[model samples]
Target: MTELPGTYESYWMETGTGPAYPALEGETEVDVAVVGAGVAGICAAWELARAGRRVALVEADRVAAGVTGYTTAKLSAQHGPLYAKLRGSLGAEGARRYARSQQEAVDHVGRVAAELGIDCELERVPAHVYAESADAVDRLREEAEAAREAGLAASFVRETGLPFPVAGAVRVEDQAQFHPRKYLLGLVADLVARGGAVYERTRIVSLHEGEPCRLTAEDGAVVVARDVVVATHYPVFDRALLFSRLEPHRELVVAAVLPAARDPRGMYLTPERNTRSVRTAPYGGDERLLVVTGEKFRPGEGGPGGVGERYERLAAWTLEHFPDARITHRWAAQDNASTDGVPFVGRFHPGSRHVYVATGFGGWGMSNGVMAGRLLGDLITGGESPWASLYDPRRLHAHEVPSLLKAQGAVLKHFAGDRLRPSHADDVAEIAPGTGALVRVGGRRCAVYRDEDGGTHAVSARCTHLGCLVRFNDAERAWECPCHGSRFAVDGSVLQGPAVHPLEPRTLPDEGPSGKEGSV
Candidate 1:
């Protein structure tokens, strides 16, 4: 078996890290508090600050450390067949509105980058949605027509920059790609210059909703904002709005240094079930980082050997296609999807007027995130934006009721199955080094991980967010919640969240030191 690459590092991470910001000192009030400093929050803060409003942007970790850092960075509005789906669900006018919003987002990014003087390697390239099969070719043709009808500069094409011949594709011209982190940090700098505060490592654990929303951090700090934007990918610790509606999906991404000759000039994706997207990032050498991403799967239900196997599959596929490629980085990124296939980017709900949310981008964060920032900023500072009604969070389509119910069913299945089914391991002695499993410890299910150094760690198998069971993600070596996509480290620390709380540790019943087994 060919060995997979090293630890979960992204090509973007190899670049300069985000500038350090001090944690929030104490109680601070702002006009708008933007939580989660990924692309969405950064964009939101940028737009609000640009509007001369006082903003405080807080992050649990560093900026762009979440999905934004790991993205393939395709800044295209041509999300695979999205316009066609939007037309089907939201009618012709709604689809056109959606396209207009995304196009403006691309323009907004360009305007912001140029205004801020950010040299983030921004490039203007075409994006292609191609397919190898005849059935998908038909879908592409229909998709191209839908895109054109919905205000995109799209046309049907026979050939893309792919290594192999594509049967059909919908090519959208003048889309783009860029280094997300650099662009985001540039925004952060501008935010500070405009009297907006940026803080890191300050995790908001509880939100108290009132006339002025008060957020209590894990430390004793408090932030009071007239309005708040819940840009935390999936809205955390929620039962009313996002949790029940959003479906979390984990996707495998691999970045390999391919010869400059084989590098494709256009951002390309397929219409396959387990969709594959191919693009390249300039790394300043003969071997540019060619990122070929796909092999998406729902969490908890096993992959080849967890996500590690998914990376291997990506590697195998890369070797088969781009034989000259040398695999360098392998990582997985999680994305949320909405029942209606349109992102929820407005007020969190009708009841919560002061709170807004931007989630379920369906792996198109660059465009959607920028749109969220622009629309949310407009709604917050100015009156309601024209685009607000199209993406209103409270508006639920009748056709989407079935999708909502279907997603709820999956969550209920995982929540109930983990409680009913027996643990994967009965005895702690069964655990081996560098692996993890759910073990029946003292008649209670606990996740156990044996480190390569022979250290034993255990935590509650149930997720801290919504009580859904967390399965081990071997590729990232973390516990991933199948329901909401929260991830935890081996030591039970929160890695990514909708779950802000870490998994509580559980003591083994009768296990002794030095790998000794005792009776329960």
Candidate 2:
């Protein structure tokens, strides 16, 4: 096995730990209830609180410690060559709305950070989408023009700050990058100081929409609010069939320490090689943490060597680009992509009056998350937002049908096909130490992992979300549902979700000579 560098963690998570909040114990009432304490949730709660609305920000875990904690933390409006594609799919005006919304989000982060005196290391830098091949240069030029037309300070440039030469690039000026947790924690504090409530370790299991929305947490505590915002990375409550329209993707990130002089000094992205995103953050004097992200794949599909190979590829790419980089941290991030490129940020469903949802950021969550906060606040406060029409969940374009079908087709493949496939091991003894596999115990399929001590732990193979068989991700050491991106630990605890319930535990039969004695 090839040795991979860096500790298996996120750089942002290691540097900052946000404040802890008490879980909801009994019935509580608020004007608004925001689910999930990620960037979108915190920002939404902050927005409502600032508007003088009594708000409760509830989270299953620590604030900003889920997808937000694992992000690359690039606060930029220049989302690759998105403008050009939007121009074609949506008209010129539609593209302009997206550009304006994202740019406003970018500015909003900086403004909020400065106003709150949060030392999030926020700094202005130009964002670039560069192309290394001649064929992609023309596309970059087109993108540059479309971006400028859509109201961004964009230009096509041949020279970039990268170590390698690029054929051409679309450069957008005045974008920024910062530490997400620091900024969000600052917002969390302000939300509390402003008479808003935040509850950590409060998992909302059910939502009842009415004149006043009722949310029930895992502990049976209830939160009654006039409005509810579902900001969980994947909508835990999929009333509008969002699971069919949203496709889940997971990406690997590798960060390394490099001399400040070697820092790129700007955020960069490229469409080549699956997808590559590059940014840097202040580590200490004369050194910067270079974070590189790429290798996108579905949750349960690990391609050849599982997620470990994806991490290896990302690390190799980082070393190839920045030889002086000494890898320090590595982790993975997940996001949902809508059938249409635009995110669904307005009403949760057509019938929903007070319930709103924000999902399908499509890997550009920082700006989109902030945009969701502002948009959701405006919708709840009855303030007019011009971009609301573009992100409305009910609006469906004819162009989205093909993509939607393709996404659902893949889901169907995973939902039914995985169960028919051969099990990983015929007997528990065939499983190697420190590895997991699907085995049949008492004529029932079970996901069993063998510890180095020869003890066996088993859970049902069926995913709680949609009956999809869970696959073991060797690199992350977790079982992942491919259909909708739910994750579980070896102990059958929910890690990430559209699935609120943990996998069902199963007991193994008595072991023979080949099987182990101890079982869980």
Number of clashes recorded per candidate:
0, 0
Q: Native-vs-model 1 lDDT?
A: 0.84
In model 1, pairs of residues that clash are none
Stretches off by above 4 angstroms in model 2 are: 513-520
Error of 2 at 53 (Å): 0.6
Candidate with best TM-score:
2
Put down candidate 2 lDDT per residue, 239-289, tens digits, no spaces. Answer: 988989999999999999999999888999998998899999998999999
Q: lDDT tens digits, residues 1-520, model 1?
A: 2368744687787784767899988899999999999999999999999898999999998878888888888898889878888889899999999998888888778887898899988888899988888777777888899999999999999987887887889999889999998999889988899999988999989888887999889998999999999898888748345778889887788888888878889898885747888888787777677888988888665465666677777778877878888788877777889988888998887788688899989889999999999889988986667789888888888999999999999888888866888887777878877788899766778888888776678898889887888888765678888877788998888888888888988877656665743221
TM-score of each model, paired residue for residue: 0.96, 0.98
Models, CA RMSD each: 2.0, 1.1
Residue 56 in model 1: lDDT: 96
Go through the candidates in order and give each one's C-alpha lDDT: 0.84, 0.92
Residue range with the least summed lDDT across 10 consecutive positions in model 1: 511-520
